[model samples]
Target: MSKRTAILQTAAANTDAATEALDLALAMASMDQSVQLILASEAVNCISDNPSKRYAMLELLEAEPILVFTDEPLSNPHQLDIEIISSQQLAPQLNSYNEVLQFS
Candidate 1:
């Protein structure tokens, strides 16, 4: 199996950039690749705000990527993989991925 991983970080309000990146990640991960999402700043809101419209958009994707947070709480049941990570610790863990995608 071909294995790949991507790290996406976003800190936007509309979240258009993050959403697009997630769609791309889902497409990539659907092909047996591993994927992870890094939430920071304002983007972290998406993970903890109970159920939002975008949450469904993310969950509907075929590939379920792991969700990593920095100073963010993990409370969503739909989140397949969730963890709290520090900004300093993020880089080393991110290095393991074959691919890394960052967005603002």
Candidate 2:
């Protein structure tokens, strides 16, 4: 069975790390690896209205479902669409992955 991967994106919006994390996730997903893209803290900004082509390409790749760890969804000024997960869910969810790549 393919190993499950959790790509934890911790970079702030518009930063290179954020894009790199997405690119890495995309690459892994293309290889038929099970991938979960999780955005943490300010990295959540990378999801929406950001000036990154990768965000649009996210739909082209079957990498989801993307997840966000937060008590409540933010105002979402940037607007990358994904599920909002509670803190309690984060640990169990991350533990489910076979590997985790955190991009700070």
Candidate 3:
């Protein structure tokens, strides 16, 4: 059987929501699921200079693939070491995935 791929889109505006989104993604990844996390719009703010949040996300990145859409430039001072894909690439990327989950 083919591995199931999942894309998790997050537009969380606050820390709590962002944390919850991260938790969900972690859970999915822990189950040996192919999970991709996309940070868009305000969701990019979740990876600010804050150590705890950044570290949490870094842990998740170690477990699964994390991506950011180029259309939404990150507003945070801290940069996340993840792949940045263009809007044009979004459709094709999603096409390769079996499921897409959005958390706003």
Candidate 4:
């Protein structure tokens, strides 16, 4: 199984970056790689979006590549994981992944 890690940090004001991160996450899912999406700082706004980009993010997560979104530290969920986490938690979480990508 391939492991992918992405940290999405787009505050409410940075919708463009946030949307781009979501798109990237979706693409990663299409590649069939397990993904962990970390939303930190103002990027938490990405999570709060109505309908939650969480669902759209999962659409790309379907099948062989599992996708999860979290801002916090926790076990990986099968479908998708959304959490409120810290930078400290992100470091260790990312270290476990085969590849790590960051989006500001």
- Which candidate comes out best when scored by TM-score? 2
Per-residue lDDT tens digits for candidate 2, residues 1-104, read 77899999988977788878888888887787788889888886665434466664555677677788878546656455578898899999999989999999
Candidate 3: tens digits of C-alpha lDDT, residues 1-104: 65655545455545566666677777766776666677766665555435245435545545554677766555445544567778898788878877777776
Stretches of candidate 2 off by over 4 Å are 48-51, 75-81
| Model 1 lDDT tens row, 2-91 | 455665667563567767766666666555456666666666766666534544544455455445656544566656445677777777
Candidate 1 clashes: the total is 0
Question: Using alpha carbons, what is the TM-score of model 1?
Answer: 0.68
Query: In model 3, which range of ten residues has the least summed lDDT?
Result: 49-58
Residues 1-104 of candidate 4 have per-residue lDDT tens digits of 54556544444535777666666666767787565555666655443444354544564466222222354444433324444445556567667777766666
Between prediction 2 and prediction 3, which has the larger TM-score? 2
Q: Which stretches of candidate 4 lie over 4 Å from their true place?
A: 11-14, 49-60, 63-81, 86-88
Error of 1 at 87 (Å): 2.4
Candidate rank order under lDDT: 2, 3, 1, 4
Pick by lDDT: which candidate is best? 2
Better of 1 and 3 by TM-score: 3
C-alpha-based local distance difference test score of model 3: 0.62
> What are the C-alpha RMSDs, in order, of all predicted structures?
3.2, 2.3, 3.2, 5.4
How many Å off is the CA of 44 in candidate 4? 0.8
* Cα TM-score per model: 0.68, 0.83, 0.70, 0.60
